[model samples]
Target: MYCETDDELVELVERARKYTEDGKVADYIPALGRAEKCDLSIALYYTDGRCFKAGDVDKLFTLQSVSKVLALALAIMDNGEEEVFRKVGMEPTGDPFNSIAKLESQVPAKPLNPMINAGALVVSNMIEGRSTHDKLGRFLTLIHDLTNNTSIDVDHEVSDSEFETAHLNRALCYYMKQHGLITGDVEDLIDLYTRQCAIKVSCLDLARIGMVLANKGRDPETNRMIIPEGIATLVKTFMVTCGMYNASGEFAIRVGIPAKSGVSGGIIGLVPPSMGIGVYGPALNEKGNSIAGVKLLEMLSQRYELSIF
Candidate 1:
């Protein structure tokens, strides 16, 4: 195990918790703004089914942008990779996750990658369903399989808040629609995308989900393949390149793990072939990542030599 005991993990959490004072919760979403900025917690799950936890491991947070990775994986499974990539490119962007500047500049007008809001919206539209309920059900089903938690569902309050304030995202959709990138009703796409972002998961649940990915889409205990190995590899590659909004490069250099962070201060990290990590700290850096969460991962990476690089 990367962390032998809960006490060892707690030490790291306390050290990283100190940095939470320097960051702030994301307030633009309104509902997300109510999060306790000082809150920090972590969980690590190994392939052997051992889990080590620290701080308030019961705390729940929305997936926010981190949902993009899961949605992208499902989209690829529903539609072949060739069809999915035709709608979204694989390149990383220097712009902020929600920025629409690149959409206007790129000749094809497709999103640079599914990690960005633009690309994620396109992926959301691609989820095969006859209606919003069907689409979200399909996504929740994937979440259930990944985490082995059938009770996992969306936080409707957070979903509503995002839908109300998603003007910038709607703008991106319209732009993409103009370029023939995304189809169907714009509002419907936004509804599905916002709910996808609002799906709630505790640190433990996140760790379990990460474990599946780290195990290359298999349930460690059952060894059942929840996702194809190729899709798992593709998603992890995006997590390395574009996961932390625009700070992905720095994170790669520092932590050297495949990770995706959400504005809700949740991060899903992987130590390939063995361990999965989940961290929650509603205090965010300027780039929208969990500041303390990132610090804790950096410390763990250094201490345990956990870098996949």
Candidate 2:
């Protein structure tokens, strides 16, 4: 009962694969290093329990920065948006995701918003828990609750790979500590943030999470609240405003969904009131967005008329 017929969805998948054939996979993380270039897939899940998938939909990939949306939403629910704002600003940085320029500027030293790496690290610290382990436990629970997927676990290999190369994020955490923007142990928070980013998921899981948000934090299938309504809207606003790094404006103009992308090359987007959609193309544009992913979303948005505006 999930789809009336998967034929149309199947056609879209074929188009996506053809459109993304030249895209490259992410290689920074050594574990993602050897992933096949042009590896593309998508999953679409509607509120009615119909699911459509195509291509390498089962392929496992790191959540990367896409985890920011969940962390930020949970932080706001745990401590209120006002408190979370004290640690991370809502304004767009207009700088690179890993840029330390804003961190060093007295004009606005705080990480701009949770979608960026620095801001996500700050948001991770704000999740209520006694220790990093406790915090991640809550995080894992949140993801599991949202996706209704119990088999999910941290990809230790990916986590370790990110940890080794996350020097920039670590430095940003240390600087934030010096600025009183982050009050916890810097090293601990950075490690916690890095670990959280390493949670592996597929297009199905990503689409399910997006579906919950599209349903205003309610699980469409179970009709249970996964995220509170208010916090869901808040997180969606942030995603719309700042989700795609410096390219968020362009994405909003084109794809017109409150979406988030991971450096691992996945994009989770939604068409509110209709469905949750996911696109995976590891080849990234210069802005760190998935080039093929963006193209596919633009076409989908145009065909479906899903833009909020």
Candidate 3:
């Protein structure tokens, strides 16, 4: 109900699209580097099953860091909150998401929060599975249920590309392993983490997932409980606190939505009790967020008074 027509959203998208020129795609990940820097799209899904979209909504992108939120939820469900938090702290870091400074400086040497690569690796390690394939299957099952799209799966190209460049992530895993924070083969853990990040989702798929979270883990259309209400709340809290890397506070002030962003230029946003938003803009700011996507969300938030704050 927030946005009455697709044209309204299209106008917003066109306005935000201008900022794409000010950013650049994430070239660090070779596969991700291939994304069109000027492309931007958005989809909004409501509890009533209404959806509004603009731009290339069918364009798929890897989840990248955004997968951390889903992995953390599953990890918490597999292992209790106490067990997961014992290995990873709930604090946000001012340093870059991939920075290793805090890991060395902290006394216990655990990653600050699950949104960062280090913490996400620990959470990925906690996924209950007999093997790497089994673990990824379980994670995919969750995604399938959330989006009602069984075809959703990892982009192996992106997975392999990320795995190839995951040297820093390997270091973080080894460091956490040394601190007794995570157990198991570092390489296997990296494989699972990288695959998890490589999961592909289109804007509509992302919006559907966000809609479930906004509805407190229930699929309004199917009337089924996809995730526990408490778990969804916890995940949303993390999205508010640490979802946008170091720019979370600024995003909160500007957009005021519980959301998660990825280096692949995807963002999943929640307008609690009603709507879920998905945005994709490959052009990234220095902080690894979708620059134009963030701007679009800010405009949508202000125009619709969508801030949960």
TM-score (all chains, Cα) for each model: 0.99, 0.94, 0.99
Candidate 2, 33-135: lDDT as tens digits: 6766677777888888888877777788888889999999888888887899977888876888888887666455787778877788888888888898999
Give the clashing pairs for model 2: 2-50
Which lDDT values do the candidates have, in the order given?
0.94, 0.82, 0.93
- Positional deviation of residue 22's Cα in model 2 after best superposition, in angstroms: 4.9
The candidate 2 region of ten consecutive residues with least summed lDDT is 1-10
> What tens digits encode model 3's per-residue C-alpha lDDT throughout 1-309?
399899999999999999999999999999999999999999999999899999978899999988998999899999989999998899988999998889999888988999988888889999999999999999999999999999999999999999999999998888888999889899999999999999999999999999999999999989999888999999999999999999999999999999999999999999999898999999999999999999999999999999999
Off by over 4 Å in 3: none
- Candidate 1, 160-263: lDDT as tens digits: 99999999999999989988988999999999999999999999888888899999999979889999999999999999999999999999999999999999
Superior candidate under lDDT, 1 versus 2:
1
Model 2, residue 175: displacement in angstroms? 0.8
